[model samples]
Target: MLQETRLIMGMPITICIAEGGAGARSMAEAFGYFDAVDRRFSTYKADSEISAMNAGRLCRDAISAEMREVLALAEKTRVDSDGYFDIRRPDGSLDPSGIVKGWAVRNAADLLREAGHRDFFVDAGGDIQADGVNEDGEEWRTGIRNPFAEDEIIGAVRLSNRGIATSGNYARGRHIYNPRQPGDELDDIVSMTIIGADVLEADRFATAACAMGADGIYFIEETAGLEGLMVNAAGISTQTSGFGAFEIQ
Candidate 1:
């Protein structure tokens, strides 16, 4: 079965799943699961888990099992990124949007696998996770949009059972602010793409790496099981060790 549907998550959530005979039905079920997770974890919602934590009604000790895992990952990312991937805003509010979307998408992919779909793809607003190749037997091809060029692709990558996430200043029009340097704007880097086994890690790494500018490349390269490529404001490109395998076409 192969099915596609939209789940509500402060917006339309389009979910797609491919399986033998129950693709549609299974995807619908997965959407239900996704909706539940969204309601519980969404930062946009006033009553979501993260909102609760921000309100002081819940702490990390009182978080749900699923959120506990996400929090742990967030903590690890904050450490690995040298505090660049923080969840707290300058005003002391939790802003997990950088990592939660990818986390949810990856979890949806896991649900699809549990439903017997060996191959699937989940794209939650550009954060992507693929379990296997597409129907053509080739790896998934992801485009790296050119920030300065309209309708142009600067590069692309072929991914297999991997997660790819991009953080760019272009998407939100300078909305990706740096909490550490509240008075300073993030310049020099236009976008950063990170690929890794975990979508959450990839997402946070990309965001933090973009904030770090040129200095972040070395950290991403040395981090085990992670690789990244960055496109700076001047359009200069730099990539880590394993990043060469993903072609820039």
Candidate 2:
């Protein structure tokens, strides 16, 4: 097994590959994918396509194909989630951040798969995508940190050929907002973790659900191929019917 962690996209990008044939080369290529995504879509960098668009220097029709794809996906999530998942801020500026992080991570994982690696894990911050079993011959288990207890692991989820993303206001501090309630802050829910078919799906819904506060769990339960666990400000935990399936024993 080979494991590597590098600071990229303003966060630690950690990757683990099992049965690595050409370890260094494979990991380098994987990281390259992430770097490319960062260069193109990052909101922090002034030269990024996203930043340029926000600055009014780039028009929608002139944007790159990849940017168009991400925006479309963001719109779809907004409509599907009843405007809970939105990239457009209250200031009316476009921001595709809610969709890009998971999309980039998922694409990076795909790069590893195309290179003939099956058992691998890619984690960008808290979002994760894992294929095949772990080095222990079991599904990869990802921890769900307790919102109240910073150092404690309240629970964990086992994922294989799937993805998990946890969105919380505690860490980001009002980073994820609700378009439906533009000015108001979402304070009812502290944490929301989603399990989905892939990283993009999981991450988008997790952000949207977290923005919905306590009502996020109900939306998650009604959605197909998505399960969520929500922790309220009072520390009450609520989950969808299928959420327990991913929880590690």
Candidate 3:
């Protein structure tokens, strides 16, 4: 088993490969991809593509293919979440951070798989895309962090060839807001976690649903092929009917 963790893109990204043949070369290449992503997408960086666009230095038509793809995905999320998942900030600047992390994780997993590493786990911050089994040849056990107490875990889920994402205010603190009502206080729910076919799918919906406050889990319950768990401000957790199926007992 090989595992490495690095602080990239403003978070601790951990990649673990269960297969014995996995090497430093593939791991380096994967981390390099994340570095490139940060350079191109980070709004905090002065020379990043996102910053350049925000500063009006780059034309929309001149943006890279990846930028265009992220923009399209953001727009789709906006529509799918009834405008609650917008990427535009109050200053009219675009911040696609919410979706980019998961997208990056998914791509990194693909890179590892392409390199013939089937049993691996890619976790960017708390968002995860796990494939195959762990070193013990068991499903990856993902612990959902408690929003009220960061060091504590509220629940655990078993996953293989699946993705999970958590959106919340505890770690980041009011980073995500309802675009429809920017001033609305999202005090009802502190965290929202979504499990989907892949990390990108789970992440985009998690961001939107968290912005929905307490109604987020209901939305997950209504959405097909998605399950969610929500922790409210009172430290009470609520989950969709199917979410129990993913629990690790």
If scored against the real structure, what TM-score would every candidate get?
0.83, 0.90, 0.92
lDDT of each: 0.75, 0.86, 0.90
For model 2, the superposed segments whose C-alpha errors exceed 4 Å read 171-187
lDDT per residue (tens digit) for residues 183-239 in model 1: 343346777888988676788788888767777777789888888888775567888
In candidate 1, which residue ranges exceed 4 Å CA deviation? Answer: 1-14, 18-20, 59-61, 170-187
What ranking of all candidate models by lDDT puts the best one first? 3, 2, 1
The per-prediction CA RMSD against the true structure, in angstroms, equals 4.9, 4.9, 4.7
lDDT of 2 by residue, 1-249 (tens): 999999998989999997766766878998998898889988889999999999999977899999999999999999988988889988778888778889998988888888888888999988999889888888898898887677898899889999999898665445443445533443468789999999889999999998887788999999999999998765678989998888887
Could you tally the backbone clashes for each prediction? 5, 0, 0
Query: Candidate 3 lDDT, tens digit per residue, 1-249?
Result: 889999999899999998856457788999999999999999989999999999999999899999999999999999999899999999999999988999999999999999998888999999999999999889998999987677999989999999999998554335443456544444577889999999999999999999987788888899998999998765679999999999987
Candidate 1 backbone clash number = 5
- Candidate 1: C-alpha lDDT: 0.75
Clashes of 3: 0
Q: Return the clash pairs for model 3, or none.
A: none
